[model samples]
Target: MGRPRVRFTGRTEADAEAVLAAAAAHDACLSGAPADWEIPAGCAA
Candidate 1:
């Protein structure tokens, strides 16, 4: 089985930071991460 997925969407830079930090704090790996994770981008897979 694969790791369960978590979705993250960021309209602004701060939103992105909060999502990344929350994932890290939970020791969750952010799969398919982009070079810049804190851009105005949303990630899910």
Candidate 2:
């Protein structure tokens, strides 16, 4: 098993942020141990 991957695509910054936040929130919720949800380096929102 491996970490889940989410692909986010949006035209506007607001929409991109929304998707990014949603992905992070979902990832955090699914994690069994304390995890860092910081946006990955080089990621553009």
Candidate 3:
């Protein structure tokens, strides 16, 4: 079976970008990424 998928629908582009940024930060923290890691351009929205 395929892995379950999760989708986020924000009311606006800005909202969606905020959600994506938060998710990226959370992921980085969990993975013990370097504090100076830069957010990808796409993820910057």
Candidate 4:
């Protein structure tokens, strides 16, 4: 199977940051392999 694809729309920069932060926290709680969650290079936040 292929990786999941998600697109966040109608959200401000802060909202996007919050989503990323939540994902990080969830990963920490699970203590599992970290997912590739990051802003793409050269993309303005």
Please say which candidate is ahead in lDDT: 1 or 3. 3
lDDT of 1 at 25: 42
Using TM-score, give the best candidate's number: 1
The lDDT of each candidate is: 0.48, 0.54, 0.49, 0.48
Give the clashing residue pairs of candidate 3, or none: none
- Residue 20 lDDT, candidate 1, scale 0-100: 70
Q: Report per-prediction Cα RMSD to one decimal.
A: 9.4, 8.3, 8.5, 9.5
Best model per lDDT: 2
For all predicted structures, in order, the TM-scores are 0.38, 0.37, 0.36, 0.36
Report the lDDT of model 4 for residue 16.
67
Clashing pairs in 4: none
Model 1 residue pairs with clashes? none
lDDT of 2: 0.54
lDDT of 2 by residue, 1-45 (tens): 666665655445746665666666657765522244555433445
Q: Which segments of model 2 are wrong by more than 4 Å?
A: 31-45
Q: What does candidate 1's lDDT look like per residue over 1-45, in tens digits?
A: 554544654446746765676566434345434432433233332
Better of 3 and 4 by lDDT: 3
Candidate 4 lDDT: 0.48
lDDT of 1 at 27: 49
lDDT of 4 by residue, 1-45 (tens): 433544445666757666676555445443332354444322224
Error of 2 at 24 (Å): 2.9
